[model samples]
Target: MNKVLLQWALFSFMFGLALSLPLAAIHYQKNSSFKGIFTNYRKLKSAHLDYFMQALSAAFVYLIGFAAHIEFAAYILIPFIFGVILNPTILLLEATPYIRSGWIRFIYRCLRATSPASLLFAWLAIAFLFLPTYMTIILLAVILISGIGILTFLIKRRSRNEVGVKITEIE
Candidate 1:
Protein backbone atom coordinates (compact mmCIF):
# COMPACT_ATOMS: atom_id res chain seq x y z
CA MET A 1 0.00 0.00 0.00
CA ASN A 2 2.76 2.37 0.92
CA LYS A 3 4.60 1.55 -2.27
CA VAL A 4 1.51 2.12 -4.33
CA LEU A 5 0.97 5.43 -2.66
CA LEU A 6 4.59 6.27 -3.21
CA GLN A 7 4.35 5.45 -6.87
CA TRP A 8 1.18 7.41 -7.24
CA ALA A 9 2.71 10.40 -5.50
CA LEU A 10 5.75 10.17 -7.75
CA PHE A 11 3.50 10.19 -10.77
CA SER A 12 1.59 13.15 -9.43
CA PHE A 13 4.74 15.13 -8.70
CA MET A 14 6.21 14.36 -12.11
CA PHE A 15 3.03 15.23 -13.90
CA GLY A 16 2.65 18.49 -12.04
CA LEU A 17 6.30 19.44 -12.46
CA ALA A 18 6.27 18.57 -16.15
CA LEU A 19 3.15 20.56 -16.80
CA SER A 20 4.15 23.54 -14.67
CA LEU A 21 7.71 24.03 -15.92
CA PRO A 22 7.10 25.24 -19.47
CA LEU A 23 4.25 27.46 -18.44
CA ALA A 24 6.25 29.01 -15.63
CA ALA A 25 9.28 29.67 -17.82
CA ILE A 26 7.15 31.22 -20.47
CA HIS A 27 5.34 33.37 -17.97
CA TYR A 28 8.50 34.34 -16.16
CA GLN A 29 10.37 35.39 -19.27
CA LYS A 30 7.39 37.31 -20.50
CA ASN A 31 6.99 38.95 -17.13
CA SER A 32 10.64 39.86 -17.02
CA SER A 33 9.76 42.85 -19.12
CA PHE A 34 8.70 45.40 -16.51
CA LYS A 35 5.73 46.45 -18.66
CA GLY A 36 4.83 43.82 -16.85
CA ILE A 37 3.35 41.21 -19.07
CA PHE A 38 -0.14 42.40 -18.36
CA THR A 39 -2.49 44.47 -20.47
CA ASN A 40 -2.16 47.33 -18.01
CA TYR A 41 -1.31 48.20 -14.42
CA ARG A 42 -4.54 46.63 -13.21
CA LYS A 43 -3.70 43.35 -14.83
CA LEU A 44 -0.17 43.49 -13.48
CA LYS A 45 -1.52 43.86 -9.99
CA SER A 46 -3.77 40.86 -10.53
CA ALA A 47 -0.92 38.86 -11.98
CA HIS A 48 1.32 39.43 -9.01
CA LEU A 49 -1.60 38.65 -6.76
CA ASP A 50 -2.14 35.40 -8.57
CA TYR A 51 1.47 34.37 -8.10
CA PHE A 52 1.22 35.03 -4.39
CA MET A 53 -2.04 33.15 -4.14
CA GLN A 54 -0.63 30.12 -5.87
CA ALA A 55 2.37 30.08 -3.56
CA LEU A 56 0.12 30.33 -0.55
CA SER A 57 -2.11 27.54 -1.78
CA ALA A 58 0.87 25.27 -2.23
CA ALA A 59 2.06 26.09 1.28
CA PHE A 60 -1.29 25.32 2.82
CA VAL A 61 -1.37 21.93 1.17
CA TYR A 62 2.14 21.13 2.35
CA LEU A 63 1.32 22.05 5.91
CA ILE A 64 -1.67 19.77 5.85
CA GLY A 65 0.46 16.91 4.57
CA PHE A 66 2.99 17.52 7.33
CA ALA A 67 0.15 17.50 9.77
CA ALA A 68 -0.71 14.04 8.54
CA HIS A 69 2.76 12.56 8.84
CA ILE A 70 3.46 14.38 12.13
CA GLU A 71 7.12 13.50 12.35
CA PHE A 72 9.70 14.67 14.86
CA ALA A 73 10.22 18.38 14.32
CA ALA A 74 13.93 18.07 13.65
CA TYR A 75 13.59 15.55 10.85
CA ILE A 76 11.37 17.95 9.00
CA LEU A 77 13.29 21.00 10.15
CA ILE A 78 16.71 20.01 8.83
CA PRO A 79 15.71 19.53 5.20
CA PHE A 80 13.48 22.56 5.41
CA ILE A 81 16.39 24.65 6.66
CA PHE A 82 18.48 23.39 3.77
CA GLY A 83 15.56 24.21 1.54
CA VAL A 84 15.47 27.69 3.00
CA ILE A 85 19.17 28.03 2.42
CA LEU A 86 18.81 26.91 -1.19
CA ASN A 87 15.72 29.00 -1.82
CA PRO A 88 17.30 32.40 -1.25
CA THR A 89 20.20 31.40 -3.43
CA ILE A 90 17.62 30.60 -6.08
CA LEU A 91 15.94 33.94 -5.63
CA LEU A 92 19.33 35.63 -5.70
CA LEU A 93 20.22 33.62 -8.77
CA GLU A 94 17.04 34.73 -10.41
CA ALA A 95 17.17 38.28 -9.13
CA THR A 96 20.88 38.99 -8.81
CA PRO A 97 21.59 38.46 -12.46
CA TYR A 98 19.32 41.39 -13.09
CA ILE A 99 21.85 43.54 -11.27
CA ARG A 100 25.26 43.56 -9.55
CA SER A 101 28.33 41.48 -10.41
CA GLY A 102 31.64 40.23 -9.09
CA TRP A 103 32.23 37.54 -6.43
CA ILE A 104 28.75 37.55 -4.85
CA ARG A 105 27.01 37.26 -8.17
CA PHE A 106 29.47 34.65 -9.34
CA ILE A 107 29.04 32.71 -6.13
CA TYR A 108 25.28 32.93 -6.39
CA ARG A 109 25.51 31.98 -10.02
CA CYS A 110 27.54 28.91 -9.21
CA LEU A 111 25.16 27.85 -6.46
CA ARG A 112 22.30 28.60 -8.80
CA ALA A 113 23.97 26.16 -11.14
CA THR A 114 22.66 23.40 -8.88
CA SER A 115 19.79 22.45 -11.18
CA PRO A 116 17.37 20.35 -9.15
CA ALA A 117 18.26 22.16 -5.98
CA SER A 118 15.25 24.41 -6.40
CA LEU A 119 12.98 21.45 -6.91
CA LEU A 120 14.57 19.81 -3.89
CA PHE A 121 13.71 22.94 -2.00
CA ALA A 122 10.10 22.60 -2.98
CA TRP A 123 10.10 18.94 -1.97
CA LEU A 124 11.58 19.92 1.36
CA ALA A 125 8.77 22.41 1.83
CA ILE A 126 6.23 19.71 1.10
CA ALA A 127 7.97 17.12 3.23
CA PHE A 128 6.42 18.33 6.42
CA LEU A 129 2.92 17.67 5.16
CA PHE A 130 3.77 14.13 4.13
CA LEU A 131 2.33 10.69 4.64
CA PRO A 132 4.15 7.36 4.83
CA THR A 133 7.70 6.74 3.64
CA TYR A 134 6.36 5.87 0.21
CA MET A 135 4.81 9.30 -0.10
CA THR A 136 8.06 10.89 0.94
CA ILE A 137 9.98 8.95 -1.68
CA ILE A 138 7.50 9.96 -4.34
CA LEU A 139 7.87 13.58 -3.31
CA LEU A 140 11.64 13.24 -3.51
CA ALA A 141 11.36 11.74 -6.99
CA VAL A 142 9.21 14.65 -8.02
CA ILE A 143 11.93 16.96 -6.76
CA LEU A 144 14.44 14.89 -8.68
CA ILE A 145 12.46 15.18 -11.91
CA SER A 146 11.93 18.87 -11.37
CA GLY A 147 15.69 19.21 -11.22
CA ILE A 148 15.79 17.38 -14.52
CA GLY A 149 13.36 19.81 -16.07
CA ILE A 150 15.32 22.82 -14.78
CA LEU A 151 18.52 21.65 -16.46
CA THR A 152 16.65 20.61 -19.55
CA PHE A 153 15.02 23.99 -19.78
CA LEU A 154 18.28 25.80 -19.09
CA ILE A 155 20.10 23.84 -21.77
CA LYS A 156 17.33 24.52 -24.21
CA ARG A 157 17.75 28.20 -23.46
CA ARG A 158 21.55 28.25 -23.86
CA SER A 159 23.44 25.48 -25.50
CA ARG A 160 26.71 26.59 -23.88
CA ASN A 161 25.53 25.52 -20.41
CA GLU A 162 24.94 22.00 -21.65
CA VAL A 163 28.59 21.01 -21.29
CA GLY A 164 28.65 21.09 -17.51
CA VAL A 165 25.26 19.47 -16.98
CA LYS A 166 25.18 16.69 -14.38
CA ILE A 167 23.87 13.17 -14.79
CA THR A 168 21.34 13.26 -11.96
CA GLU A 169 19.97 16.57 -13.22
CA ILE A 170 18.81 14.98 -16.45
CA GLU A 171 15.35 13.59 -16.98
Candidate 2:
Protein backbone atom coordinates (compact mmCIF):
# COMPACT_ATOMS: atom_id res chain seq x y z
CA MET A 1 0.00 0.00 0.00
CA ASN A 2 0.96 3.65 -0.42
CA LYS A 3 2.27 5.69 2.55
CA VAL A 4 -0.89 7.59 3.43
CA LEU A 5 -3.06 4.53 3.14
CA LEU A 6 -0.57 2.49 5.07
CA GLN A 7 -0.37 5.08 7.81
CA TRP A 8 -4.13 5.37 7.88
CA ALA A 9 -4.39 1.67 8.48
CA LEU A 10 -1.79 1.80 11.22
CA PHE A 11 -3.54 4.74 12.81
CA SER A 12 -6.87 2.94 12.62
CA PHE A 13 -5.41 -0.25 14.03
CA MET A 14 -3.01 1.07 16.66
CA PHE A 15 -3.70 4.74 17.29
CA GLY A 16 -7.29 3.68 17.12
CA LEU A 17 -6.52 1.58 20.17
CA ALA A 18 -5.08 4.44 22.17
CA LEU A 19 -7.89 6.56 20.82
CA SER A 20 -10.27 4.40 22.79
CA LEU A 21 -9.09 5.51 26.24
CA PRO A 22 -10.38 9.09 26.39
CA LEU A 23 -13.44 8.06 24.46
CA ALA A 24 -14.09 5.11 26.73
CA ALA A 25 -13.42 7.15 29.86
CA ILE A 26 -15.93 9.73 28.76
CA HIS A 27 -18.42 7.01 27.97
CA TYR A 28 -18.05 4.92 31.11
CA GLN A 29 -17.77 7.91 33.43
CA LYS A 30 -20.86 9.44 31.91
CA ASN A 31 -22.98 6.35 31.59
CA SER A 32 -23.31 3.75 34.30
CA SER A 33 -24.03 1.22 31.62
CA PHE A 34 -23.20 0.61 27.96
CA LYS A 35 -26.61 -0.67 26.94
CA GLY A 36 -25.93 -3.56 29.33
CA ILE A 37 -23.73 -5.34 26.80
CA PHE A 38 -20.78 -5.00 29.16
CA THR A 39 -22.83 -6.09 32.21
CA ASN A 40 -19.98 -4.64 34.28
CA TYR A 41 -18.82 -1.01 34.24
CA ARG A 42 -15.33 -2.06 35.30
CA LYS A 43 -14.90 -4.13 32.17
CA LEU A 44 -16.03 -1.22 30.10
CA LYS A 45 -13.43 0.98 31.78
CA SER A 46 -10.60 -1.53 31.30
CA ALA A 47 -11.53 -1.82 27.68
CA HIS A 48 -11.07 1.93 27.23
CA LEU A 49 -7.58 1.69 28.63
CA ASP A 50 -6.88 -1.14 26.27
CA TYR A 51 -7.98 0.86 23.28
CA PHE A 52 -5.87 3.79 24.40
CA MET A 53 -2.62 1.85 24.14
CA GLN A 54 -3.57 0.48 20.78
CA ALA A 55 -4.30 3.95 19.46
CA LEU A 56 -0.94 5.21 20.67
CA SER A 57 0.87 2.41 18.90
CA ALA A 58 -1.12 3.03 15.76
CA ALA A 59 -0.21 6.70 15.88
CA PHE A 60 3.47 5.86 16.14
CA VAL A 61 3.18 3.66 13.09
CA TYR A 62 1.15 6.29 11.31
CA LEU A 63 3.88 8.88 11.78
CA ILE A 64 5.94 7.07 9.20
CA GLY A 65 3.56 8.45 6.61
CA PHE A 66 4.79 11.93 7.46
CA ALA A 67 8.08 11.02 5.80
CA ALA A 68 6.32 11.19 2.43
CA HIS A 69 3.88 13.55 0.78
CA ILE A 70 0.14 13.19 0.23
CA GLU A 71 -2.19 15.60 -1.50
CA PHE A 72 -4.92 15.86 1.14
CA ALA A 73 -3.66 14.47 4.46
CA ALA A 74 -4.50 17.50 6.51
CA TYR A 75 -8.12 17.61 5.40
CA ILE A 76 -8.39 13.90 5.97
CA LEU A 77 -6.98 13.80 9.53
CA ILE A 78 -9.06 16.85 10.48
CA PRO A 79 -12.39 15.44 9.44
CA PHE A 80 -11.43 12.01 10.72
CA ILE A 81 -10.59 13.36 14.15
CA PHE A 82 -13.46 15.84 14.39
CA GLY A 83 -15.76 13.52 16.24
CA VAL A 84 -12.86 12.29 18.34
CA ILE A 85 -12.22 15.82 19.52
CA LEU A 86 -15.87 16.69 19.98
CA ASN A 87 -16.73 13.64 22.01
CA PRO A 88 -14.36 14.58 24.83
CA THR A 89 -15.18 18.28 24.67
CA ILE A 90 -18.83 17.54 25.24
CA LEU A 91 -18.17 14.90 27.84
CA LEU A 92 -15.91 17.18 29.87
CA LEU A 93 -18.44 20.00 29.74
CA GLU A 94 -21.04 17.62 31.09
CA ALA A 95 -18.88 16.48 34.01
CA THR A 96 -17.94 20.03 35.05
CA PRO A 97 -21.02 20.29 37.23
CA TYR A 98 -20.39 16.94 38.87
CA ILE A 99 -16.66 17.49 39.35
CA ARG A 100 -15.84 18.42 42.96
CA SER A 101 -12.58 20.40 42.70
CA GLY A 102 -14.06 23.26 40.72
CA TRP A 103 -12.04 25.02 38.02
CA ILE A 104 -8.62 23.61 38.84
CA ARG A 105 -9.89 20.10 38.96
CA PHE A 106 -11.91 20.68 35.87
CA ILE A 107 -8.93 22.02 33.94
CA TYR A 108 -6.67 19.29 35.17
CA ARG A 109 -9.17 16.65 34.30
CA CYS A 110 -9.64 18.10 30.82
CA LEU A 111 -5.93 18.29 30.09
CA ARG A 112 -5.62 14.71 31.24
CA ALA A 113 -8.81 13.54 29.66
CA THR A 114 -8.96 15.10 26.19
CA SER A 115 -5.35 14.54 25.05
CA PRO A 116 -4.95 17.62 22.85
CA ALA A 117 -1.21 17.11 22.60
CA SER A 118 -1.86 13.80 20.93
CA LEU A 119 -4.09 15.57 18.45
CA LEU A 120 -1.38 18.10 17.69
CA PHE A 121 1.11 15.34 17.27
CA ALA A 122 -1.27 13.71 14.89
CA TRP A 123 -1.21 16.93 12.88
CA LEU A 124 2.55 16.91 13.02
CA ALA A 125 2.45 13.35 11.82
CA ILE A 126 0.29 14.66 9.02
CA ALA A 127 3.02 17.14 8.28
CA PHE A 128 5.63 14.41 8.27
CA LEU A 129 3.62 12.15 5.98
CA PHE A 130 3.30 14.84 3.37
CA LEU A 131 6.17 15.90 1.13
CA PRO A 132 8.50 18.19 3.06
CA THR A 133 7.89 20.97 0.54
CA TYR A 134 4.17 20.62 1.09
CA MET A 135 4.68 21.26 4.81
CA THR A 136 5.28 24.99 4.79
CA ILE A 137 6.78 27.01 7.60
CA ILE A 138 3.55 29.02 7.69
CA LEU A 139 1.59 25.98 8.74
CA LEU A 140 4.02 25.25 11.57
CA ALA A 141 3.83 28.86 12.67
CA VAL A 142 0.06 28.77 12.74
CA ILE A 143 -0.05 25.60 14.80
CA LEU A 144 2.43 26.80 17.43
CA ILE A 145 0.94 30.27 17.66
CA SER A 146 -2.57 28.95 17.97
CA GLY A 147 -1.51 26.53 20.67
CA ILE A 148 0.03 29.33 22.71
CA GLY A 149 -2.99 31.55 22.37
CA ILE A 150 -5.38 28.84 23.40
CA LEU A 151 -3.18 27.86 26.33
CA THR A 152 -3.01 31.46 27.52
CA PHE A 153 -6.77 31.87 27.36
CA LEU A 154 -7.38 28.70 29.33
CA ILE A 155 -4.87 29.70 32.03
CA LYS A 156 -6.40 33.12 32.42
CA ARG A 157 -9.91 31.78 32.73
CA ARG A 158 -8.84 29.22 35.29
CA SER A 159 -7.00 31.79 37.39
CA ARG A 160 -9.93 34.20 37.31
CA ASN A 161 -12.25 31.47 38.50
CA GLU A 162 -9.73 30.64 41.21
CA VAL A 163 -9.84 34.16 42.62
CA GLY A 164 -13.52 33.72 43.28
CA VAL A 165 -12.76 30.54 45.16
CA LYS A 166 -10.17 32.35 47.28
CA ILE A 167 -12.59 35.10 48.17
CA THR A 168 -15.14 32.52 49.25
CA GLU A 169 -12.55 30.84 51.45
CA ILE A 170 -11.74 34.18 53.12
CA GLU A 171 -15.37 34.93 53.75
Candidate 3:
Protein backbone atom coordinates (compact mmCIF):
# COMPACT_ATOMS: atom_id res chain seq x y z
CA MET A 1 0.00 0.00 0.00
CA ASN A 2 2.65 2.45 -1.10
CA LYS A 3 4.77 2.16 2.00
CA VAL A 4 7.31 4.66 0.72
CA LEU A 5 4.70 7.39 0.33
CA LEU A 6 3.32 6.52 3.72
CA GLN A 7 6.76 6.83 5.29
CA TRP A 8 7.38 10.26 3.79
CA ALA A 9 3.97 11.42 4.86
CA LEU A 10 4.68 10.36 8.41
CA PHE A 11 8.08 12.04 8.27
CA SER A 12 6.45 15.27 7.16
CA PHE A 13 3.98 15.04 10.00
CA MET A 14 6.79 14.53 12.51
CA PHE A 15 8.66 17.53 11.17
CA GLY A 16 5.55 19.65 11.56
CA LEU A 17 5.28 18.51 15.14
CA ALA A 18 8.91 19.45 15.71
CA LEU A 19 8.19 22.95 14.44
CA SER A 20 5.74 23.46 17.26
CA LEU A 21 8.68 23.84 19.64
CA PRO A 22 9.73 27.12 18.01
CA LEU A 23 6.17 28.17 17.37
CA ALA A 24 5.39 27.98 21.05
CA ALA A 25 8.49 29.97 21.91
CA ILE A 26 7.58 32.65 19.42
CA HIS A 27 4.09 32.98 20.79
CA TYR A 28 5.22 33.10 24.38
CA GLN A 29 8.05 35.51 23.73
CA LYS A 30 6.21 38.05 21.64
CA ASN A 31 6.40 40.60 24.41
CA SER A 32 9.68 39.60 26.02
CA SER A 33 13.41 39.46 25.38
CA PHE A 34 13.19 36.42 23.15
CA LYS A 35 10.92 38.37 20.87
CA GLY A 36 14.04 39.48 19.06
CA ILE A 37 14.99 35.89 18.29
CA PHE A 38 13.44 36.08 14.89
CA THR A 39 13.73 39.13 12.68
CA ASN A 40 10.09 38.80 11.67
CA TYR A 41 8.36 36.76 14.29
CA ARG A 42 4.91 37.14 12.84
CA LYS A 43 6.04 36.03 9.41
CA LEU A 44 7.92 33.11 10.89
CA LYS A 45 4.88 32.03 12.81
CA SER A 46 2.75 32.33 9.71
CA ALA A 47 5.17 30.22 7.72
CA HIS A 48 5.39 27.69 10.49
CA LEU A 49 1.64 27.40 10.65
CA ASP A 50 1.51 26.96 6.91
CA TYR A 51 4.03 24.16 7.03
CA PHE A 52 2.23 22.39 9.85
CA MET A 53 -1.12 22.58 8.15
CA GLN A 54 0.15 21.52 4.76
CA ALA A 55 2.14 18.63 6.18
CA LEU A 56 -0.82 17.47 8.20
CA SER A 57 -3.00 17.63 5.12
CA ALA A 58 -0.45 15.73 3.08
CA ALA A 59 -0.29 12.98 5.66
CA PHE A 60 -4.02 12.56 5.62
CA VAL A 61 -4.18 12.61 1.85
CA TYR A 62 -1.49 10.02 1.61
CA LEU A 63 -3.09 7.79 4.20
CA ILE A 64 -6.50 8.04 2.60
CA GLY A 65 -5.16 7.55 -0.89
CA PHE A 66 -3.26 4.47 0.19
CA ALA A 67 -6.33 3.00 1.77
CA ALA A 68 -8.40 3.81 -1.27
CA HIS A 69 -5.89 2.28 -3.67
CA ILE A 70 -5.22 5.58 -5.38
CA GLU A 71 -1.93 5.76 -7.26
CA PHE A 72 -1.86 9.56 -7.60
CA ALA A 73 -1.04 10.26 -3.96
CA ALA A 74 2.61 10.86 -4.75
CA TYR A 75 1.71 13.89 -6.83
CA ILE A 76 -0.06 15.48 -3.88
CA LEU A 77 2.92 14.85 -1.61
CA ILE A 78 5.49 16.52 -3.90
CA PRO A 79 4.40 20.12 -3.46
CA PHE A 80 3.85 19.92 0.28
CA ILE A 81 7.19 18.18 0.78
CA PHE A 82 8.97 20.92 -1.17
CA GLY A 83 7.13 24.06 -0.09
CA VAL A 84 6.23 23.05 3.44
CA ILE A 85 9.06 20.77 4.50
CA LEU A 86 12.07 22.02 2.56
CA ASN A 87 11.43 25.76 2.42
CA PRO A 88 10.46 26.33 6.03
CA THR A 89 13.24 24.02 7.21
CA ILE A 90 15.74 26.29 5.49
CA LEU A 91 14.11 29.38 6.89
CA LEU A 92 14.27 27.91 10.35
CA LEU A 93 17.91 27.05 9.86
CA GLU A 94 18.57 30.74 9.20
CA ALA A 95 18.13 31.31 12.92
CA THR A 96 21.12 29.12 13.66
CA PRO A 97 24.63 30.56 14.21
CA TYR A 98 26.16 28.05 11.80
CA ILE A 99 24.07 29.35 8.95
CA ARG A 100 26.22 32.47 8.88
CA SER A 101 29.23 30.43 7.75
CA GLY A 102 30.29 30.96 4.14
CA TRP A 103 29.25 27.62 2.69
CA ILE A 104 25.98 27.51 4.59
CA ARG A 105 25.14 31.06 3.57
CA PHE A 106 25.95 30.18 -0.02
CA ILE A 107 23.60 27.22 0.14
CA TYR A 108 20.94 29.46 1.63
CA ARG A 109 21.43 31.98 -1.13
CA CYS A 110 21.14 29.26 -3.76
CA LEU A 111 17.96 28.03 -2.13
CA ARG A 112 16.62 31.58 -2.02
CA ALA A 113 17.30 31.89 -5.72
CA THR A 114 15.63 28.61 -6.64
CA SER A 115 12.84 28.30 -4.10
CA PRO A 116 10.44 30.59 -5.92
CA ALA A 117 10.52 28.33 -8.94
CA SER A 118 9.65 25.30 -6.84
CA LEU A 119 6.98 27.22 -5.01
CA LEU A 120 5.51 28.53 -8.25
CA PHE A 121 5.28 25.08 -9.72
CA ALA A 122 3.78 23.72 -6.54
CA TRP A 123 1.26 26.55 -6.46
CA LEU A 124 0.40 25.85 -10.07
CA ALA A 125 -0.28 22.21 -9.30
CA ILE A 126 -2.40 23.04 -6.25
CA ALA A 127 -4.18 25.84 -8.09
CA PHE A 128 -5.26 23.45 -10.79
CA LEU A 129 -6.96 21.41 -8.11
CA PHE A 130 -8.98 24.21 -6.50
CA LEU A 131 -8.54 27.60 -8.14
CA PRO A 132 -10.08 29.33 -11.10
CA THR A 133 -7.80 29.96 -14.06
CA TYR A 134 -7.90 33.73 -13.52
CA MET A 135 -6.95 33.37 -9.90
CA THR A 136 -4.11 31.07 -10.88
CA ILE A 137 -2.85 33.72 -13.30
CA ILE A 138 -2.93 36.33 -10.55
CA LEU A 139 -1.01 34.00 -8.24
CA LEU A 140 1.54 33.46 -10.99
CA ALA A 141 2.02 37.21 -11.23
CA VAL A 142 2.51 37.43 -7.49
CA ILE A 143 5.10 34.68 -7.67
CA LEU A 144 6.90 36.53 -10.44
CA ILE A 145 6.98 39.73 -8.43
CA SER A 146 8.28 37.90 -5.37
CA GLY A 147 11.01 36.28 -7.42
CA ILE A 148 12.00 39.65 -8.89
CA GLY A 149 12.13 41.18 -5.42
CA ILE A 150 14.49 38.48 -4.14
CA LEU A 151 16.75 38.87 -7.14
CA THR A 152 16.80 42.64 -6.75
CA PHE A 153 17.72 42.38 -3.11
CA LEU A 154 20.56 39.97 -3.85
CA ILE A 155 21.93 42.14 -6.63
CA LYS A 156 21.77 45.27 -4.49
CA ARG A 157 23.50 43.51 -1.61
CA ARG A 158 26.28 42.24 -3.87
CA SER A 159 26.76 45.64 -5.46
CA ARG A 160 26.88 47.29 -2.06
CA ASN A 161 29.54 44.86 -0.90
CA GLU A 162 31.59 45.45 -4.00
CA VAL A 163 31.54 49.23 -3.52
CA GLY A 164 33.02 49.06 0.01
CA VAL A 165 30.43 51.52 1.21
CA LYS A 166 27.87 50.58 3.77
CA ILE A 167 24.78 52.68 3.89
CA THR A 168 23.47 52.45 7.42
CA GLU A 169 19.98 53.08 6.26
CA ILE A 170 18.45 53.87 2.90
CA GLU A 171 14.98 54.86 2.10
Best by TM-score: 3
TM, every model: 0.33, 0.34, 0.50
- Candidate 1: Cα lDDT at 45: 37
TM-score of 1: 0.33
Expressed as tens digits, the lDDT of each residue in 4-57 for candidate 2 is: 444444443454366355557556587634333334444444444434443454
- Residue-pair clashes per candidate, as listed? 5, 18, 0
User: Over 4 Å off in model 3, which ranges?
Assistant: 1-6, 22-47, 60-70, 73-80, 126-171
Assess the local accuracy of residue 171 in candidate 1 as a C-alpha lDDT between 0 and 100. 42
Compared with the true structure, the alpha-carbon lDDT of candidate 3 equals 0.63
Candidate 3 lDDT over 1-171, as tens digits, reads: 345545655666677677667667767766654446555555566556656665665566566556666555455456545654567656665654546778978877877766656755655665565567898789889989999999999999999786655454341
Instruction: Write one digit per residue (lDDT tens) for candidate 1, span 8-55.
Output: 334434444453443455456675444322234333333334334334
Better lDDT candidate (1, 3): 3
| Model 1 weakest 10-residue run by lDDT | 1-10
**Ten-residue region with minimum lDDT total, candidate 2:** 83-92
Each prediction's whole-model lDDT (CA): 0.47, 0.51, 0.63
Q: Every model's Cα RMSD, please?
A: 13.3, 10.7, 7.4
